[model samples]
Target chain A: MTRLTRSAALGAVGMLAASAPAFAQSIDEKVNEAFANSTGWFVSFIFSPFPGTTFPWIVMWLVVAATVFTLYFGFVQFRTFGHAIRLVRGDYSDPNDAGEVSHFQALATALSGTVGLGNIAGVAVAVGIGGPGATFWMILAGLLGMASKFTECTLGVKYRNEYADGTVSGGPMYYMTKGFAERGLPGGRFLAILFSIFCILGALGGGNMFQANQAHAQLTNVVGDYPGWITGVIFAGIVFAVIVGGLKSIAKVTEKVVPIMGVMYVATAVVILIMNADMIGWAFGQIFAGAFTGLGVAGGMVGALIQGFKRAAFSNEAGVGSAAIAHSAVRTKEPITEGFVSLLEPFIDTVVICTMTALVIIITQQLIIDETTGLYMLNEAGTAIATVDGNSGVALTSAAFSSAFGWFQYVLALAVILFAFSTMISWSYYGLKAWTYLFGEGKTTELVFKVIFCIFVVIGAAASLGPVIDFSDAAIFAMAVVNIFALYFLMPIVRGELGSYLDRLQSGKIKKYN
Target chain B: MPSKIVVGFDGSESAKRALDFAVAQAKAKGAGIVIAHVLEWSPYSFLTPTELEERHKRRGEELARAETALLKPVVDSLKDSGVEVSTALKYGHIAETLASVTKAESASQIVIGRTGHSSLSSRLFGSVAGSLAQAAPVPVTIVP
Candidate 1:
């Protein structure tokens, strides 16, 4: 009696299986189209051009803020560079500090967050589009952004909220509200709200989605192509396990794995640079010359400047206010200590790590060079440097690495996955904090944001949502808009803290440990 | 002459024996006993930003829990004894914190139980007793 119905059911299941790919494809297409339609206006507005130029208003916003902070703080990043290293080494740390975190812990957590895909795929994107000159601007932005990080993190710690249960909460939101109010400024609440909204959305898009999408792409490069949803589901499950399920050991493993990968990736780049030792001078010559002349690169020097600053800001996240959230948890009584320590974030992430990636790509000659003109060759669209094997982003970086060591591609794949995983977990926390700020902090409230974040991981990987990614990029820069605005006002407070701390150091009021 | 002896405690049987040995030594010398309890933590491990934010709260709870469940009961049990006893608690590396407590309390000697932890971390990092033996600034007595 059951055989006939079971056979019919089996046939139906087989038919569904056969048509699943088509069904999934149509579903993905619809999702992408819907997101693109909705986010187009928002994306266009955020990336709107500056006056009399093709450059994005957002990029200009970050570059201008960084320059202002560098001036306002009197080039604090350069002045405090030595003190920052001392702080990170715990030289001035007191054993009696109220909390347990060290300067190193705070710096490591923030570094792991920023020194990820932005260094890998992001550098490739910059160098590929803007040519070698972009590296110059990128390094300049990173160095200047150090001051931005210092100012914001100083405010983050000073204006932070210490709850009765002893949990600490801070970031641009707190400083925006409290710092402005202390100065009798208006719209403080409004700015905090805007920053929180963008932080939440940016966390979802840039932090969760973009990471997953890139991790999937890297995996596909190493292995054969499969449905991105498979990767999405797996990543979501692991992230959910960490944030929601509270299986923190998984996160611990990834966090540990990522740093080792970072070191290995750096070592690989170092090896490539050493092998092509002769090209070292040539590469820097290309970087400096291309920065000015663009060497016939697409969009010329202007294009290089755009990609360089954009990627640097994206990589270091100095002015974006996210690092402020991580640094806010430090145990020090002197908020200025965190500021001094944080100046190193952009230095390490952008100046040191990103430059290494760029140098390798330039030295490896991944970008096609024009034989006749002695300039860079451009793709048919003239939008970017034409690359060997048409590679771009992480693949271009991978090709450059593998050019030196054939099996390095697999190592790069593993590194990309760990980097993505760590970034996802960190971003999940950043988004939760923002969500809680908007909707009062509570157990269930945090859970809702976490679940939504995990869902975005799936959406980002499974679907081709270009507009969605663009919207997230815009959202992050929007955070800088609100954050840098507050920092402009709060710089005086940081100046006071810095002055007193320096005086204390001079007077031996702050003990130096052996 | 009155002197102070610092004893490491975690409510383990080995710690209890160490405490007993310290009490006897203190009684013989007419000295005081400082029971030092260190909640082990490493600043080196990775934590999510969420975990980092809530760490202070969790630390407070753990300290409270250690005092009530681990330290206070043992001190209460010894209330009838004549030797003056006090407790010192902190969060840090076990050996370092104990040594710091000894220095802060100006204790003449340090006492700890030789407890065995077969976990791989202990294998890599060495047991608390092992580290304390090496790092203590004063004379260290490992009671079996």
Candidate 2:
């Protein structure tokens, strides 16, 4: 009787295994549908092309905001550039007096948030689709976006909520509610709620999913192809333990690891550029020539502009209001001082870091530039360079790394995994804040969001990159839509704060400690 | 006063014992008492920007609480003890910072409570008593 029962159980297990693929495929389809539906509307709304142009309205939306802020503030990003460096250097800080965060700390945290997959995978995507010309527009956007960062971060600190328990919760939502009310404007709460919704979605899609998917993609480069869900589950387990299980030591480890890896990544790029020193000028020529003449790419300069601005905003998070959240916790009586420090973020992320990544990809000649036409060369099949590795984003970047060092893909994989993990944790914090804002802060309420976030890590890791990129782009850009809207009316208050800070500095009321 | 005695205080029972011991020493030596409260702060400690900002407020509150609830009452209790009393509050590594204050305030000696804080940490990172003994500018007395 025991033998017969065991044989019957084995038969049943075999039958289930035979049907598992069909069952899993159906569940996968349902998940894809649900996920696509979750963010499709917002993505479409933000990414829809403007009338009679190939450009997305969202691109124009951010460019115009950055330009206006730069002009209105009298090009503050450039004028205050040196002073911004001094602030980060603590030239004005009194070490004896306790400030909540050093200027460098605030800037470092904010930079860590913006400088991850977006610089690696996202830049590859831009340079791939928009060509080397995208680098020109990216640097341009980074400069102007500094002004946008300044306006929002100043408002973030000024209107930040300081609770009785000494907890701080500030971002576009807090600033929206308070700044709007202070200005006696309508729809403050409505806009705040709207911004929170976008922020939560953005954090989940762009911040969480994109990081997971790209990390898994890089993992596949080192270890041969396997089911993404397998890697996703492993990532999810550790991430859950860290974020949900309150494993802070791992987060701290990553905090130190990410910055060190970032520096190493940049230094490697600098070495590669130095090794191929002669190609540096030619690479710049490619960037410049490609920017105007379109270099046989479709939509000419406008296409590059759209990709450049979009990825710049995506990479630096300058206009996304996420930096404002990170910077708001800065210890400063003068809110504008934090703003000055914040300008470094875009410069570093886009102008310095992203430019390094772009130049490496360019000088490596992986994109296969046509010397005669000064255009990006398509394969014999006429497909773009994205097809080189069957995976464009990080793969294109990996290909470039291998072109120089051959074994560099291993290092790239490590950096990508660390970067992706660190980014996921950072985004989890951002999502948690937005979640608690929408749903009142409670232990149970927070647990729900944390669990949900970990689950998405698996989903992101399993899914293909296309939908993830779309959802991520849309959600993050949607945040910009609401945040930049708030910045428009709120600029006057920031200007007032800046004026007072400058007057005090000039009069020696605010001493320069160094 | 011709001399000063620096007492490390953290509102712990052991710390109170140290303060009492310090009071006795000050009286015996005709010295003043300087209460020092050192907060453990490291710039390298990894923290979110939000946590860092919120912590700054708690640091201020912690100082205020030490001043009123911890230091003031001690000063009052010793008002008639004919010993000069003052407080020095700072944020830094506990043992090294206390030692630095001993040097900064020109104290003759230091008195601190022997704490039973995490034997595991003590084994790994060394106890505050051990650090103070090694780093103090003058003699250190660890009151039982």
Instruction: List the DockQ of the predictions in order.
Output: 0.57, 0.32
What is the model-wide C-alpha lDDT for candidate 2?
0.83
Candidate 1 chain A least-lDDT 10 residues: A1-10
lDDT of 2 at B5: 92
Strongest candidate by DockQ: 1
Backbone clashes in candidate 2 total: 0
On TM-score, the leading prediction is 1
Candidate 2 RMSD to the real structure: 6.3
Model 2 DockQ reads 0.32
List of clashing residue pairs for candidate 1: A133-A291
